[model samples]
Target chain A: DTAVSQTPKYLVTQMGNDKSIKCEQNLGHDTMYWYKQDSKKFLKIMFSYNNKELIINETVPNRFSPKSPDKAHLNLHINSLELGDSAVYFCASSKTGWSSEKLFFGSGTQLSVL
Target chain B: AQSVTQLDSHVSVSEGTPVLLRCNYSSSYSPSLFWYVQHPNKGLQLLLKYTSAATLVKGINGFEAEFKKSETSFHLTKPSAHMSDAAEYFCVVSVGTGTASKLTFGTGTRLQVTL
Candidate 1:
């Protein structure tokens, strides 16, 4: 079974469009995170949720918001997506909120904003 | 705060040759370090992690890393290289306290192993 899974492995959308990426983890982890991999392949954390509560919020634009309905799911919604938003988004989860815990990552979703 | 730097952006090696990917880190407190491998179009996979454990930590796929506090380094090494080992490797560090803790990833190093 895939421990961490994200839907729509490839997404192509036009500028100013709204899109959402769904993520689910069956690892029974309490902490989930959203990371963005830019064109340079530099991964940066965007948001983190522990037990359905937002714990960490980076300097991401207000157009992007993460919603966690429960401990098992964390979804990212992007509003008025711009060309710069074209990048791979990864979903990850860990056993706890501790940084020492190893993370399980999904295959990643490639979003292209034309 | 904590951060990790991967010295080499790309490294090429021949089969059976030794492999070394350099990494340096800076942190205000004791840190947790990790090495992750990412094959093309795949998710990142944990190779090994060091969390106040032995200085020499061994991981799967015949990979290992040594944590040197004085040098502030956790470099991944392998005695022999296999073609299948070609991938992008990332050095990561996690620091801070409580639930506020966060992980910082290096730019990544692409490894090319030839037969």
Candidate 2:
């Protein structure tokens, strides 16, 4: 079974448009995270949810919002998407408490805002 | 503060040759280090991790990493390189525990395995 899965593997939209990326994990982990990878392949954490509660919120733009319907699902919604938002977004889940070191990552959603 | 540094931006090795990707990290508390590999257009995969346990950790695909606390280094090594090993490797460091834990990733090292 796929441990972590995210929808919309590729997204292409014009500027000022809105889009959303859905993510789910079947690893039965409590912590889920969203990371953004730039063109240089630099990965940065954007948000994290533990048991459906927001835990870590980085210095991302206000246009980006993350919604965790439950512990198994965390979705990202971006309003007024801009060209700078074009990047690969990854969803990851990890079993907290004992070891939060190992994170299972999704294939990733490549977003292109023209 | 926690940070990770991959000494090399890229490394190229021929098939069957030994491969080495150096990494260094800094953290205020007890740090758990990890090596993650990402193929082209793919997500990151865990290769190995070090958490105050064995200094030398073995991972899949004939890969291993030795943790040197004295030098704050966790370098990934493979006895033989395969073409499939061409991917970007990331060195990460985590300080906090449980849900509080956050990972700091290095810029990444792109490994090219040539035949």
Candidate 3:
């Protein structure tokens, strides 16, 4: 079975629009994370949730919000998306808390804001 | 602070040739090192990891890595190269002291296997 999956593999929207990307993991993991990869391919952590509890919130803008309905699902919602927000978003999960170094990442959602 | 550096940005090798990808890392405390591979338009896959266990680690696709603490290096090697091995490789380092350890990834190395 697919360990981790993300919806909306490609998203193209206009500026000032709002969008959401959903992620699910069946690895029975407790920690989930969202990372953004820019055009330069620099991967940066945006948010992390452990057991549906927020753990790490990076220096992302206030418009980007991460919601975890449960341990198996973590979704990202962006409000007033701008051109700079165009990038690939990846969702990952780990077995335990931050102590575990191995992470299973999803295919990623490519967002393009025109 | 923790960081990872990949020595080569791009490497090209012929089929059945030996492959080497060098990686160096620095950390304040006990660090966990990992090698991840990402195919075009795909997610990252864990090749191997070293976490205070055996210094020599073996992973899928006949890939292995050696961790030398004295040299502060974790270099990946393969006996033979395959066309399917063409992808981008990343070296990652993590220092988990609390409940929220974050990963720091290297710039990445692109491997090109030619026939």
For each candidate, the DockQ is 0.84, 0.67, 0.68
lDDT of 2 by residue, B27-52 (tens): 88888899999999999999999988
DockQ for the candidate 3 complex? 0.68
lDDT of 1 by residue, A8-89 (tens): 8999999999999999999999999999999888999999999999999999999999999999999999999999999999
Q: What's the true lDDT of residue A81 in model 1?
A: 99
**TM-score, per-candidate, Cα-based:** 0.99, 0.97, 0.97
Candidate that beats the other on TM-score, 1 or 2, i.e. the better one:
1
**CA-RMSD of model 1:** 0.6
Docking class for model 3 is: medium
Evaluate residue B54 in candidate 3 and report its C-alpha lDDT on the 0 to 100 scale.
94
Lowest-sum lDDT 10-residue window in model 3 chain B: B94-103
Model 3 residue pairs with clashes = none
The runs of at least 3 residues in candidate 3 whose Cα sits more than 4 Å from the true structure, single-residue gaps closed, are: none
Model 1, span B8-86: residue lDDT tens: 9999999999999999999999999999999999999999999997999999899999999999999999999999999
Fraction of native contacts, model 1: 0.75
Candidate ranking (TM-score, best to worst): 1, 2, 3
